[model samples]
Target: MKLKQITEVRYITRDWDRSTVKRVVKKLTNGKFVRKNSGPNTFYYNVPDIEYALDNLNVQFGEPATKGHYRTSQGDAAYYIWVVSGWKFKLSAMDMKLEVWPSGDISDKHNHFRDRYDR
Candidate 1:
């Protein structure tokens, strides 16, 4: 999607990490850069097609903490593997997006990103 498509944005006006929030917005909006506006002190970005993202990706909340979280062990195992496999993640009210790497490199960045939001 084009970068300027992100139109609607929402955020809590408490103390938050600026760069991390922007990164999440950019990812959710398909890499579009987010800018701040003054009128009421809001930080917003563009999503070329929010419907497409909402419709296409398999958005999910907290990982299945246990086997009960998944319908089957296979699913749970897969989820566990994916979580530990070092994918950069950003979670929103919508779903979680993993910044997958070409070589499948899982690193501390994933945890750092997760820690920023999963308080």
Candidate 2:
């Protein structure tokens, strides 16, 4: 829970580490960079459903440093980025568009992204 400025407490995942968060965020470069494509170009969902995804992100990773967030239409997607530990966290919302690095060990994340955001 957020405490006084002198002593704020944040509940994070068991494996959560600031360095890990930074590392992962850096891999994306930013919200628009992807290395390899694995899923369909885009998946359309209701706005509330996508919003639930956003809420679930907060529950999973604590709150991120909310950055630019804008939604156009249901099918017309836009990024809702967040900065955590000085890194741009692009995968917070399922609306995220990511390209996985073929040589990296982040295939699981890619799969999770596809599963959650896929129709």
Candidate 3:
């Protein structure tokens, strides 16, 4: 299937236009790219694509994910920054985005997503 024309990815934000989401999805893999209701409209993507994101995001992706050091990089299209919020976060490739704060484990790296959608 063409990644650019995905329907599985669901966004609850107003700024996430169809073309914008499609453009971002085209660059990502593993199928589900979710947009949050708050926090700069960060487009939460797949962690499996972390390597591709890190290598291509113009920064070290895995290091921050495992070591818990926040990292970010500028993207080319439909996105502003590609991020691996290494700060007290964890990997979450759920069938649906978790609406609750699962835990207060600061060391858990509760943030693990790839980009901030361009607005």
The prediction achieving the highest lDDT against the true structure is 2
Error of 1 at 43 (Å): 1.0
The list of candidate 1 runs beyond 4 A from truth reads: 1-16, 34-41, 55-119
> Which of 1 and 2 is ahead in lDDT?
2
Candidate ordering by TM-score (highest first): 2, 1, 3
Could you give candidate 3's per-residue lDDT for residues 34-57 as a string of tens digits?
A: 454423433444445543433332
| Cα lDDT, model 3, residue 35 | 56
By TM-score, the better pick of 1 and 3 is: 1
Worst 10 residues of 3 by lDDT: 93-102
TM-score of each: 0.29, 0.29, 0.26
Tens digit of per-residue lDDT, candidate 1, span 33-114: 3433312223433446545443323232134222223345434311211121222232132222322222233355555666
Clashes of 2: 1
Give the better candidate number (2 or 3) by TM-score: 2
Q: lDDT per prediction?
A: 0.34, 0.38, 0.33
Local distance difference test, candidate 3: 0.33
Q: Which portions of model 2 miss their true places by more than 4 Å?
A: 1-19, 22-53, 60-75, 91-119
